[model samples]
Target: MATTSFGAMRGLLNVKFFQTNFSAMEHRSDIKKDNKMKEFQRILKSLYENLIMLELYPRSQIDLQVFVLESDGSYKSAAFNAVSLALMNAGIAMKDYLVATTSGLINNVAVLDLIYTEEKKQNCEFVMACFSQSKNIAYLSLNCNKINAKDFKNLVEMSQGSCDQISQ
Candidate 1:
């Protein structure tokens, strides 16, 4: 994905075919198909829509699958990065590189690229996925345990910074 580390987190990315039931003459199934995809699978569709030249392959189907070989924490971030690379390896067109990272606020202390143990101890958790060049978030998921407003703000900033660092 973004980085290879001795860190326990591990990820895998795979691509599969897209399936939809619409008349070839209609050519309007993409919208409907998206509505039916699972949240995780739908994420791949979003990335394809945002970055790929889908018009180049009209009526074509492309699907992506991501697996966590192992995990310590930040699995979502790793999965995003892995899929980006898989797209590149397939010679697919792209707007830019995609990268991601995770952060957690534990004991009022902010930590970057959290490990599983650290995540288990956190007051809040944050994850972000964004384009490296555009720096626009494709996805963000945050969970808090009664975290204060100020701390929540700081966590967002910290997560953004971590996401940027991975992109670089």
Candidate 2:
């Protein structure tokens, strides 16, 4: 779940993550201590910083609170898509629609939207976000080591196609 609010503050934006008792996969009570959660927060913040028209809200900040209800593969990409929708619903001005998706390489083949099981079996996974209209990448994360240039290109292409489909 994501809740976004525009408020008068010093920073341009702030993102926070919370996990409820129902979040079975999260063992920590304090989200700040969880490195993965902190990383996600940072990633989400960067993804929106450039897309949002911050100049319009001078001396204000956009607060985004994301709740992790479950642990699943491709959650990072899911969060980006969720926040984008929330901002749009709130009538926030943006340069373009942000679309994100996860793709992985299994047996040297590029695959899209891997479930938890498939994600573990992947040789590498790519989390990518791009503007739907411009098709310019806003963020990219590769979760593994040692993917050849050709295979990396294939995964990027596959991820872009997946993002396009999700945008549609």
lDDT (CA) for every model shown? Answer: 0.67, 0.81
Spell out the clash pairs found in candidate 2. Answer: none
Question: What would the TM-score be for candidate 2 when compared with the true structure?
Answer: 0.82
- Give the poorly placed runs of model 1, Cα more than 4 Å off: 1-38
- In model 1, state the lDDT of residue 156: 73
Maximum-TM-score candidate: 2
Instruction: Give residue 102's lDDT in candidate 2 (0 to 100).
Output: 90
**Predicted structure with the largest lDDT when compared to the true one:** 2
Estimate the TM-score of every prediction.
0.69, 0.82
Can you write out model 1's per-residue Cα lDDT over 35-129, one digit (the tens) per residue?
53356566665565667654444435556766544566676677778878888899877778778888878889878888878887888788877
